[model samples]
Target: MRRPWGLALLSLLAGVAAIAVALGPLLASSGGVHGFAFSTIGVGAILIGLNALRRNRRAPSAGVLATAVAGIGAGAIGSVAMLGMLVTSPGGPTLLPFAPAGPVVAGSTGQWAASTTQVTLTSVAVVGVGPTKQVVVGNGGSVRLAAGYSFRSATSNPQLDVRLERRVAGGGWTATGIEATVAPNAPLTAATPAYSTTLATEAVQYRFASGTSASAPVSVVYENQHLYTGMAATIYADAAPYCPNTAVEIAHLGGREAGDYAPGALLIRISTAVGVRANLTRASQRALALHECSHERQWLNYGGSQEGYAQMKAAAAADFTVGDNGAPPIEHAADCGAMALEPNGYLGYGGFCTRAELNEGARLLNGQEY
Candidate 1:
């Protein structure tokens, strides 16, 4: 009996592909060991069945039949595992069939820590434009809430319910309706929409909930009421070590720019129209301000506007000519710097930063003067 070389080769190739799929991005993102096990078992069983078929092409042996049956059973289990991976991976397909009713009680126990920034009056400024006319131009700032969770679970699927709650006037906690279902074993970082406290002060709290178990409430107070004020305040605070005299103000940029930094004036100007837009969230607004502040640090490091602007222009022109990575070196540096200052909040850079740039950004953020 000539060995079925073609069948053997096909089985090997299919087995390798199956294993690759098992250990690929889906498994990496899910951070689940069960996925790997199921995938391995499924691949092994399928290979075993294929081998049995190749060896017993003419004679249907009882042992081959039993082996094939076992292989099928393992393959079914593997299919279920693959389905779970798809459901859990970020941006993966939704598990419409297995969707839960209400919040799925987390299968694992976890604890969460809250990160909050308070809105302050310093972010808002009242200026007298004329003898009798006064203009309020700075942001009134809002409370920003972000949570990081750590979980311990023995089960294959572990999820946690994260919620951001606000304290009402009567002191009762009300759900802000901002929530997310996250895997416990993975990097669990969740944030609520910035609470608008520009009209009045607000108390915001956050927690992690799982099957009637909840982490202790963590809270922060926001006490400012001007548009984009909190974002400006956050930028100023983060930039204080680098640019002590940094100032932020709301200005009309005529839709030409979201924000800009004036080197000599030490001013960060945020667009009024952009800030007031309904869809713009506070986190994104803060990210914009921080990006401008990075330019401010760059200017100070470069000595003055003459040197800084010249270098920036040259970099921009070169980037345009070469079509380098969609952003100029200066802009890329600023994006990295902003991310360094607010790792969880800033989402502008789209993860295009190099290691050297990221390190420089950290140094620039930490008062590394020219």
Candidate 2:
């Protein structure tokens, strides 16, 4: 029993060492473990300690005190040394260093932070599919973020710079106006002087060495008021660029036609880059045309009902109108009521208008005595 006790203690410590090695990478940023080689060696030391303990335990006549002391010494030294290297000098990691705050500036070019003009830089993001990474800095009351830096480094080039592109929601990531850079050797940190934007719901993701990443999307709020039919139409037109490939589909009454419905022309009352740039893919154009045609047929059979139904479907799918606007629940309900009664065209009276207009439209559509 006494002989085996020494082995048990050593084996336990060895297991602890191995665990530290495996967890080293995960805790690297926080613990400051720099090189993979060092981590592996640390793990091996733990294994050695474990094996020593096992050997002594199996030797019935072995000196229990000797075996226990040897195994414990090996494990203790290896574990302490591996952990100590993390926050030390030379190759020591640079993550949790303390620092002073600074100033911030904003411009069309981008938002920047610095103590002086020479060191100033804007918060920028370079996107990629791998691990997400980010840097957050405060500028006055505002905060700026730069994310999506690649983990791999360039040969000979010590300065690791990343590129980011500007694009709308649902659009392919592009490498246009967005860009950011950081020094690998520098301590990970936050700078002072922040910048703000109206797009609070937007998210910025950060990746480190291409694996699992983190995202911080913004938050915001606003109100939308009721508008006349024509006004609503105009607003849609003005916000065309924001809605890209989107257009108002009006249901047309079926004249003495044989088919249930005839497709309506895609209207472009307000010129949006999406509307003006005729480069819509064949499939996209076909889908849009077909959708509108469905509305026309529905209108002839029912009055003013198509938009409401479509909007309702959109809501169910969690697909909200993006970029330029949103749809209120009241308006959605009103539109649904209008479609139930007049399936053909926009009766222009049901959706989110004044209570009087809505009640009157609802009553007439329901065939109730007004």
Weakest lDDT window of 10 consecutive positions for candidate 1: 119-128
User: How far off is residue 148 in model 1, in Å?
Assistant: 57
For candidate 1, the per-residue lDDT at 16 reads: 48
Tell me how far candidate 2 lies from the true structure as C-alpha RMSD in angstroms: 17.1
Q: How close is candidate 2 to the true structure, as a TM-score?
A: 0.25
Candidate 1 has a TM-score of: 0.33
Tell me the lDDT of model 2 at 338. 40
- lDDT by residue for model 2 (1-370), tens: 5546644565555645545654443333322334435555445545554555566545543455455555555556655655654433223322311211221111223232221112222222221111123222111121223332222111111222233333334564444333343434322222112223343223332221211222232211111212214422443332232222223422332342111212121122221332234343433333233323333322222322234335434542342112112544423333433443334433221233335434533443333322
TM-score for all models, in order of appearance: 0.33, 0.25
lDDT digits (tens) for residues 1-370 of candidate 1? 2243433444444454455555455453443454445466556657665776767667656555555555545555555556665455332322221121111213334233222111110011111111111112122222222223333232224334555455644476666676643442222223434444544344455443433344345443343423235556655565555555455666787765677764433467777765467245666665676688777666555544344557755643443221144555666677776666666555353546555666776676565531
Best by lDDT: 1
Q: Which parts of model 1 are misplaced by more than 4 Å?
A: 1-235, 278-282, 308-325, 347-351
User: What C-alpha lDDT, on a 0 to 100 scale, does residue 200 get in candidate 2?
Assistant: 22
